[model samples]
Target: MWGRLWCLLLSVLTATAVPGPSPRRPSRELDATPRMTIPYEELSGTRHFKGPAQNYSTLLLEEASARLLVGARGALFSLNARDIGDGAHKEIHWEASPEMQSKCHQKGKNNQTECFNHVRLLQRLNATHLYACGTHAFQPLCAAIDAEAFTLPTSFEEGKEKCPYDPARGFTGLIIDGGLYTATRYEFRSIPDIRRSRHPHSLRTEEAPMHWLNDAEFVFSILVRESEASAVGDDDKVYYFFTERAAEEGSASFAQSRSSHRVARVARVCKGDLGGRKILQKKWTSFLKARLICHIPQYETLRGVCSLDADTSARTHFYAAFTLTTQWKTLEASAICRYDLTEVQAVFAGPYMEYQDGVRRWGRYEGGVPEPRPGSCITDSLRSQGYNSSQDLPSLVLDFVKLHPLMARPVVPTRGRPLLLKRSVRYTHLTGTPVTTPAGPTYDLLFLSTADGWIHKAVVLGSGMHIIEETQVFKKPQSVENLVISPKQHSLYVGAPSGVIQLPLSSCSRYRSCYDCILARDPCCGWDPSTHACMETTTATANRTALIQDIERGNRGCEGNRDTGPPPPPMKTRTVLRGDDVLLPCDQPSNLARASWRLNGSVGLSDGQGGYRVGVDGLLVTDTQPEHSGSYECFAEENGLRTLLTSYSLVGWPEPGPAKVPSASDPSVSSPGQLVLLRGRACRSRWPQCHRPLHGPCAGWS
Candidate 1:
């Protein structure tokens, strides 16, 4: 009895001491490959418009005339949106004066890159004019452009608060209700500012940099209207997305580092704000901000953002691209997270965070909140109480808002984690479009541009996100500055330092067989049984019911429908000396499929089994002997379906002399001599015993 009691006690103690399972950590990345990769040379449908100017950062789509307005350094071009490179484009050269350039160069700036008229802001001022701003050799200038003739007026407005003096500084603006709302840096060393221009009574952020805006790097801004279903009448609001340095240590909900750490944020202000009456005169009174959490522990820096605003404000969603800064980890990775507009609004309606003077840290406000709610837009209820605008708000409410601009609760993502995460790729910009499938479900098609000049086309699924394909848009790797999508034309316009590229959103012609088409899982494509080809299922295509589409499950096979396709390419024979290493090539069928090798009739190339290993592109065999002289076949398995991808015939002969193993430096060896790194469940389970370390062990495994 004593022994049994002692054993039970020990077991209970062990169970109590061990920590419960931690909350599920955010996914590092989705384990899948693009189904197809089309190089720049094979992309015949893509059109490009190149020019001598650089940094084509700003792009505005004019759907009225089917024109794409490109804002480049010292020039602006109007190209046909349907075909950007079809013919000659209208261009206007607007260079800064020599005196301005001299002054810019005298300030110790690089004349080649920095001292130039880089057009930064471009918006439609009206139906026939465009509001343009540029860094004219360190002197900011804004002017109106004649859209018909592509001509600039002689007079210009002083772009002090409308644009940034340095072309490299972060800036973003939008024109709404004849007012230009802009967020940019004021001067060379000043803190970032958000203000309204081209308005009768323009409001700006408070002068308190630490509490208002601290070293913010703006990415995107947009206007959102209230839904008509709501009972309360509210004003439309403008929201800005950016990354700023933390004002206090551990201020954000998920923050675990120092105060200097940067955090992604979303701030909003009402459009009807008329500034405080006296205390905060000429300053916004309904400004509030909250932190945006992408993932835990790392990958927090915001790189870029895009929005899919629907007719109903509740259905609007914002997608953001994030990466790990050098302060956290040194990996070239990026992640995409999405948030609903209602979730964001809920956070602002929650408790407010205030800096505690006693502890020198930020904490939730414990005092009573002012009436009408601090940082609330003017509503019908406020109007009934004799408050018409922000200027009519009481001083007590304004004082509370001035000190408590940060919200206590952070806005979490829609699915509680990132939609898509990728490693070894840095997404510079992204845009999304909604596509309704024949199955009565709508999927978002995301076009992500990487820093290496590749565009990844991915579709959001009920389970997660899947990358359909990747295309090399540019021959030479260059960062994509702007990406736009035209829904009516079914096209995507990509702007980079080199030029603009116009490509169709759907490439259904690339898939030859029903198996390939269904395996791609592209929402816009369907396998047509009549034509025996994969075709787009948009309204433009006929006979929609006859097309076979199984996006959720890609188990449909060619055997169930039409005749089997032509036989795969003939098997290739390779002759190798005994004791020599050889590599057999095989292409992957799709990213979701797994590849395995079969020798004769049995499975071969089991990891580290009999000197056989799997590589990224193919199978690698070492110490080749006559026993290996047999037919080898590669099979891709997905959704419990096995398909033959490639077949190889390996023949080995006795060596003339002593056999020598190939070294890394051997000129005759072409293989990389490295084994494939497993992903997903296998990789995670294998590394479960180890934790991420600052040095050695798992760090060197990769």
Candidate 2:
């Protein structure tokens, strides 16, 4: 009897053991850095709007009105979308009452940060007004704002299920027709829920022993109108993306299970899902969720999601940014995966997963599923079978749905892998824009924002993605909270903790030469033979026929003829005192190429042990001597072709006037020669215009 008891105990322990974490593999898809990095200070035409408080988290773009609405802590702002830097923005201050702050403090919350109002949800209610909600001193509240006046009344609606009580938690909502569908934690209860409000009969997830949403953190929600694109007259669906704890029985407790393994999920509910008359009253009857598989072993967590909807349903795609969760936050790598709408729909139509009561485990249901499908919308075929709405469904169907809300299959990403992968970078948000080239092909450009205040722009190709460039939007490290792309305005509005910044859609003029323009693989940029400049295709309407673009094969499209080999090298004269340090700027246009400095027609100054060293932005020459003076040229080599970027004539002079240096305390004592010398030493990276014909053609360099 003791041997039998020991065997039973061993079996139970073996069954309860959880699997270990998946092994990490090196990513070879994309580089961590982009081809070019432009600092925030070096960026031109960038607009900014500082928020009144912290957490500038939400943004709404009104394209028709040419305005952008920002929702921040204790305030809201309205800026001119075209030019936000004009400093003529409108503001409205909305803070919590003193009583609410006192109550929040009594409840053990921080009075300074947690007691203030934080706007979390902003949705368009009508043509003239917007529905906004905020965390009001740990009490959720919402109100309507007049678009023209940009003001709100004192009255508010209780926003328990519409918004999160804690500003730190994640929540998402979408307003379809007149109803608001939201995924958030129940106010003051901390229970994760998905519910629909503002309807005839409000519906919420079931409060059963099997929690439908297990410690979920919402990411994004969208409405997909299936009726418009379907021949079966299907009801519209509202889809939500989030990460939640997996439902697996183990030796760990409930709290440990929640923090142990997380699974990214995509759930959908019918827009017309009325409560069942007999079984599931005031609850969702047609709700089903599936795993969003991005990689093997499913170890990544969803960070952000964006959709690229096309005219056809088959062409529509959704891109998601996920980070490896097994490692620490700073060491995590991000993966970008693309999912087609059809694949997601197919998974929803597959088998269901059910929990076994006797075994206390979850697995694919072996029993026969109810007729007409449990989690199916009211399609034309279902209507023919005596099911007009969800309330008319049979009790057996509702009972099946209540027991099985998970799908047996998961929605795998396109190509069975991530499209782009980068280690040591955590992408917080992303947006996509489609650009049509002059060559009659369209390409999608993805803008990925990192937690470290950088935005990487990449173009999608047939096999993978190629990063065009990166721009530092903020001086300090901060996560990009929201991003929106406006093709009509030709700009990208980024929302962060600091403020909102407006960046141009394409910086084509930054590329100096035809070779650089063609090699960039930017779909929005093309070389114009008429003007001999790189110009944006949208604004280059004068000479469309003379435009050249080659995204697939790099610079091979510009082989036959060009204005000249390369631009005439811009030569500058620099004079520095002996023994003083000197810096020669040699900004490389392309990251794929190698840059080196050639002094006096030879490459001897780049040895690391000597005073000369090559840096990313320029070459630094320490302890400058008279022998260091020479004609220096910076060359970028790519595909065995050397291109001259810049040329500088360095001249060292003997110290004059008793070797007296300029003193910081004596501003008036500064001299013109000293000013010129300071200006020469302060090297700046800029695109040298080819319009100046000061030097001959760069024949050997090209």
Candidate 3:
């Protein structure tokens, strides 16, 4: 719900944001929300008198103990990730004091989830400790809690710059080596600041406009990365992803009256760049950033927070979710894009964006380069080149770094095309685990959450994607706030306005037949010939090298399950009066078939005799006669290939005897060409004089 409200609130900024470069044409040729037969089981979490909205604040997952730590208004609860069934885990109360709660209420915040001290931040500090922060009634406070004991220590750490004063404030932080790197608003939430705490002379980047950040919306992730290519003495770095307004461009090509436009961006800071000796002392000198290009083809920039995940390798591959926006700042479609961490580094190594007065444009630097490039890793080679430390950099280079912190190159996705695209649906979160078939082939099985409280499971095979299923997570239409998977990746934890539900990632048993099971292409499942059903063959405890090795992705050997042995017995006949139409039942599942009717046995039924009309429901024989009795068969086809479905036979009722006969020559009798009416049936059986079609008082028969 918070994610939805944020989308609506962004409309207020539409009238002010200036439009930028046109978006690229989206390369996705097909988009779909595949209806899946996948199943899920919902479990309950800790509930309170104030209701479940409190549980919607923050959810952090720890895999070792299968414990999910939830931070809410004045409370901290832990639920077992495997199943949050009734009374699964007890909640630990850590709300603000009575005075703080009342103070927040007096400040005009809602008394329920807002006015109370909401635990807004939670990060793993160590094996036994968890660092957390709460919006203490509009005043931020931080504390270290004992994870094993579930108790807060006596010492309350100062939370300034670490936790936001409001629950909805744009904030992001990462913990490494007992230190916190945070990017948030400072000086009463007006100026954006990036800071590093937990050390002497803590390094803090200068305020926004003075640095790189602008009016950013939200932060997705704070990734700590180390490159194998790093030279000796290079420290790992911390990177942040968010959407910020473009820096002021006084280029002559564009209009000066244009409003500020939002751009997806990535900024990073070195872990060892303590500070400058005099100029930027106690500040980060290695702070640098670049633009991230993630617009929908033919659409504008991407907006809002997306789930950030990575695949392991030499250079990590990041898979992120994004919603496309128009020039007007309204969100319309969603896409999932992949990025390599190596790309981010490449952009940082490029030129800095600087204003060129002579050319009247912001272009690549034509000026002399620094001995050691600004923001470059402090490797031994770079250090030997007269750049012993950040302090040794000349004022000209530092000034250029300060004035133009943006990179010349923009970060592009690894693949030119997005893996999945959804039009008219907001895809909020995405998380995937790599699955290896027994045959040693690997693929990504993605689980994406929608704005309408549904989760979609899809697998990308070759150039095509199969949407396995769409399962409802929330009972009502509430947006998924956050999603996380258990350590083993078998269980999914979805956060909603209600409570978190632990859903099994794969439902192998739901696929009853071998055809459906093999067609699933789910890495966790395989069709077992002995059991004749889908089974969870991929397991952490078992050697899956063989179980998933020869994956039947082509769905081979499923023909035996199709029952091609013989056609069903001839259908039973239905009695109908002469001159009456026949109704045949052609049963099938909804939208799963296109029925084609054919005359199996000819009793001389055709257009010249009396053919059939196909209605939205079933097949209808136009006219019925004793000679019209024949076999009518229906076949269904899906994707491809046609199969016999059902059949029906029509047998006409014998003509009545002389005393009870209905005269066909009677003017009141209905003809076979006329519509069947209940009155006509009665006239034919009881009122023999009016048995014929009711033409002009039955004068012809008279």
User: Best TM-score goes to which candidate?
Assistant: 1
Q: Give one clash count per candidate, in the order shown.
A: 0, 0, 18
TM-score, ranked from best to worst:
1, 2, 3
Which candidate, 1 or 3, would have the higher TM-score against the true structure?
1
Candidate 2 ranges beyond 4 A from true positions: 1-26, 248-259, 296-298, 310-312, 327-330, 561-586, 596-634, 639-642, 646-702
Off by over 4 Å in 3: 1-28, 35-53, 186-188, 227-234, 248-260, 297-315, 327-331, 356-362, 383-396, 462-465, 487-489, 540-702
Tens digits of per-residue lDDT for model 1, 1-702? 544543443333223221222224324335346767888888967888887787888999988789899999989999988889987789889788888899999999889888899999999998789999999998889999999989999899998779898998889999997899999885787778899988988888887634498889999998887735658998888899998987654524436555567778999999888999897788889999998886542336888888886456878888888874433244445767788999899999999999898987778888899898999999999999999988899999999888989998888777666667676678889999998877678888999998888999988775367888899998888889899998777889998888888999998888787777787888889888778888898853667767777777765645577522324667766656676656676666566677788899685667568756565456656667788789988877776667777787877768888654344454433334321222212322443332223311222222
Model 2 C-alpha lDDT per residue in residues 336-361, reported as the tens digit of each score: 88888898999999988888889777
lDDT of 2 at 600: 88
User: Residue 490, candidate 3: how far off, in angstroms?
Assistant: 0.8
Stretches off by above 4 angstroms in model 1 are 1-32, 208-210, 227-229, 251-259, 297-299, 326-329, 556-559, 563-566, 571-584, 599-632, 648-702
Give the per-residue lDDT digits (tens) of candidate 3, residues 247-286. Answer: 6353432234324656677788887676777667777888
